[model samples]
Target: MGAVASQDKQATLKGSEPSVAPLMRLVEPGMARVNALILEMAGSHAKMIPDIARHLIDSGGKRLRPMLTLACAEACGYSGENHVKLAAAVEFMHTATLLHDDVVDESELRRGKPSARMLWGNQASVLVGDYLLGQAFQTMVQVGSLDALAVLSKAASVIAEGEVLQLVAAKNLATGEEQYLKVINAKTAALFSAATEVGPIIAQSTADMRRAMAEYGTQLGLAFQLVDDALDYGGSSMTLGKKVGDDFREGKVTLPIVLAARAGTTEDRTFWSRTIEHGEINDGDLERAIDILRKQGAIAATVERARSYGDKAIAALAALPAGAHRDALEEVVLYCISRVS
Candidate 1:
């Protein structure tokens, strides 16, 4: 399955969308240290630990969450090395979640390659995920900031709750927009918020600055997930790092599906019921689902919602001191939303 965008639209997007080059360049030095720390922490006496960890870590993820921690700490004028440990912890937490998520979603692909669960089996994937989480906490302890540990540990709990909430809500057509937002808020935004918040905590920045960074991260995360939800129905596999209809096929009710199902016709409702609610998907069901989403303008609406959150994220950045890091962070938000444009 592929997206609906044409060659002309892709060409236009190339010129219009913001590039992540600035953020990447700004964080390069810190990310080098963070990368090395990640590898060191992931190592263990058991060879399978590092092998499974390296498989996903070496995969071409953008490492955006850890970069956010590095960028925020620098943006706040921190000159200490604890930020490096914190950044590694953030990445480990993210990797662990991805490993666990593959098992939960029964996903075959991640970052455009076979998932760890597919190659290593579900038991290995789950155990490796647990091992990574332990490493993450141990690294956080090394950071010597109780506040950072509190924030990240709370995020871990919230993420687990969010995953459970999503599992309970799966394939339930009655699930509304509010419940859907709650699910993403816990599942996605919690870690993003924690990732940015720890920067200020480690930097010993002002309370106001910490609040501003937290808000920025939360809004950026919401925007990021919303854009991903849109892309799942309207993007190419190369662009998404997974199949286009994975959400629909898995019976996950994201925002686009909620909006479309709410406004669709009686026959459309029945179609959703059978395919999504009852998991009775047929050969052409994915294409039909995409057509309905397009017809109802759900995809466009989802992108618009993401842009609104992106605006809030940028607004939150205003509280920070002006510098290249701040500007680069804003660009990161734009780059995230630009995936579907």
Candidate 2:
């Protein structure tokens, strides 16, 4: 998640395109099982739950997190079928979070389509999210590993805590890089770490190896989120799945803005205060913000930061066994950081 792959399929950058197919290739069979299980478990008596859940589920995503579970288990030499259940559980947890997050962020679009809250009401989205959470736990229980269950449960709690923390920090320009990192670490990295950790926990691998896998996922997650933050301002709506500048419009104080604010002149600080702190955005504010970020090298710096975490992720993989799965995992970190390129 070891050394960055030198000759893998994902070694070359493709502008804003993320390289996930190699990882997908390595775990295609397992991912198929996870997908089938997801569809089966999404069923409900009410029908609405499946409808709303599938709306986003069917939308194209790389399913990177679930792949990590499957690949990590394979990396740990797990021959059992329990990883399929764990992988599906990871995806359910992710989809549930997306549904709840869209409601909380008041987002209208997700994965290039109408958000669940846009078609269904906020109540429906919230209820469907709860339904998915129940399904996730049910699948986790099916895995029958108490340690895996414990890790996932803690991740669920930490994800909620991260969301609450972000809400508290919203529109607060005083929030610094450290505070923002804490938010993403809990919100995003916790699940990622748990996803990989459960694989070793199920495989009954050494404690050192399990910890290494967890750290690998944690660093990869941090790199992934930082790149996403950069893309929100710099990438297109087609690539980002939502409108560009959504964070700015919503007054989310991300890393780029944090860097710019710290490096900007007094006039730039005033602009930041008006747009991000007070929500007094105007027509050209987004453009101005982008220009300021460019001039201040905020975006470039954020990409550099992501690369650092990607390197750390690769280093963490050193403790895992060497094989195609391990190599694919290393390429994943490279691909994540490449999204910002």
Number of the top lDDT candidate: 1
TM-score of predicted model 1?
Answer: 0.95
Cα RMSD of all models vs. native, in order, equals: 4.3, 2.6
Which residue ranges in model 1 land beyond 4 Å of their true spot? 1-16
Per-residue lDDT over 230-327 for candidate 1, one digit per residue giving the tens place of the 0 to 100 score: 99999988889988899999999999999999999999999999988999999999999999999999999999888888888888898888889987
Tens-digit per-residue lDDT, 59-160, candidate 2: 887788999999999999898899999999999999999999999999988988889999988999999999899999999998889999999999999999
Error of 1 at 134 (Å): 0.5
Clashes of each: 0, 0
lDDT of each prediction vs. the true structure? Answer: 0.90, 0.89
* Each prediction's TM-score versus the true structure: 0.95, 0.95
Model 1 is weakest, by summed lDDT over 10 consecutive residues, at 1-10
